[model samples]
Target: MKKPSRDFWKDSAFALASVALAFAYGSLTWKRDLPNLFRIRAGRPLAEQAQEPNPSLKFTGARGRPLRPFLFTGRTFDVFYFDHVNQPTAEFARATLQATSFTYATLPFANFNQADFRGSYFERASLRGADLRASHFAFTNIIQSDLTGADLRDADLTSARILLTKLEGALFNENTKLPFSEAEAIARGMKRAK
Candidate 1:
């Protein structure tokens, strides 16, 4: 049998090395970018992924409907229905949210400073640790909502109802207006502070 040429041996070794290099590069790229790829597919930027809640977990509404997207900023909401939707759940300092129904919506730690919420409804909504200072809640229905650890200084709650709402540990000042009397407000857990 004829011996293989030296050039053939060299060509085979070079091909083997190329294949190994290609495999290593492909694997490293995939491993490093897999999470980012999934985040992009879900239509969320990578920087915001860590800040938002886990997308795999879902929220079900009172009527068994899938939760809708009620999380936004600096935008107007007309007759909007805010249920248990959760995502980007904060930092709406200058928004104009006018929801018709905010029943059972969980908006904890949101920044609503200088925002306007006229003619909105927030029945049974959870707004713990929110910042509503210098904001407006005129003619809003905030019945049975949880406002624990919330800041309401300089806020206008005129004509806003807070029947059965939780305001324990919440901060309010003389500038914060409530439809109820001062005694009634304190009786319902709303506090006066500086």
Candidate 2:
């Protein structure tokens, strides 16, 4: 058998060292550097890409299912339908979630304090035990949605269309503004918060 040349061993060592260095670098900067790679388009540098208005990123969920992309603006979600999505205990305090749909979505124990939900739809959505303190629900539809044990202190629901919504044990303070009178709200199973 013929013996291998000295240059062959040198080349093999160089290739192995290069791969190891690349892997180490990638592991250290994956979070910051890897996202920039995705932003680049058509051989253009990342700097050339226009800065997005919102820092929040858009992502797709549920592979192999007919689901739309979930776009976020800070803590806000504009004009998106989150039907059948299960996101319990989610935090969205002081968010501006305008014109969104939460049909059949499970959002129990979610924190939506002071959120603006104007013109949103909440059909059959589970918002049990949610913190909706000071939230705005103007012109929104709350059909068949569950608000059991939710906090509605200082919340505004003027002109909100509520139909068959469950408000058993939900808390509402004196500062809470509703579409109906306090007596009517109490008749609908909403409790006054201490």
Candidate 3:
């Protein structure tokens, strides 16, 4: 039998890593990937883009608690950041914020309802079920934030980027401020807009 060569594992790992990098890069370069990449890059830490997200640094939630605004009183986080917080559950809900730069935070379930997230950058944050009702997002940079189930009732998404995403469960009433055509369609439960 032939003996296994030295550095075999290293070479295999390198190849695998290379493949993963290529795939990720390819996905990012695609038109559909631009918004997400921009969102993630924008929210990256000033020191290191690859730094592991530390929710503890700017937040005061238990290990098991989700990333909710009510739970994260006076906490800090944003769009262009890496949010390894709540990785196990991948949740951030009901969080109150103001003038924070979250360009690319990876908050899949970030609940932003009833929270004050004015001037926050959610360009690429995954805002699924992030109840944004009665919140003020004026001039908030939400270029590519995922609004799949996010409730926009009474929320101000005016002048938001509103990139390609799902608006299935998002609510927008007269009290809400929208981007005219798109917002109107979304408010009426229209699909295929995002």
- Compared to the true structure, candidate 3 yields what TM-score? 0.49
Off by over 4 Å in 1: 1-71, 87-89
Q: Give the TM-score of candidate 1.
A: 0.60
Off by over 4 Å in 2: 1-74
Writing each residue's lDDT as its tens digit, candidate 3 over 58-171 gives 321223234332234334455323333333223234454655655445554555556666666655556666656677776666665567766677777676656655666666
lDDT of 2 by residue, 4-123 (tens): 899999999999999999999999977555544563113222222213354333221222233222222236666645556566676778888788777777778888988999999999
Regions of candidate 3 where Cα sits further than 4 Å from its true position: 1-70, 73-96, 182-184, 187-194
Give the higher-lDDT candidate: 1 or 3.
1
The Cα local distance difference test for each model comes to 0.69, 0.74, 0.54
Q: Would you estimate the TM-scores of all the predictions?
A: 0.60, 0.64, 0.49
Instruction: Report clashes for each candidate as comma-separated counts.
Output: 0, 0, 26
Candidates 2 and 3 compared by lDDT, better number: 2
lDDT by residue for model 1 over 8-54, one digit each (tens)? 99999999999999989989776335534442222233234324454
- Identify the leading candidate in terms of TM-score: 2
- Arrange candidates, best TM-score first: 2, 1, 3
Task: State residue 94's C-alpha deviation in candidate 3, in Å.
Answer: 7.3
Ranking by lDDT: 2, 1, 3
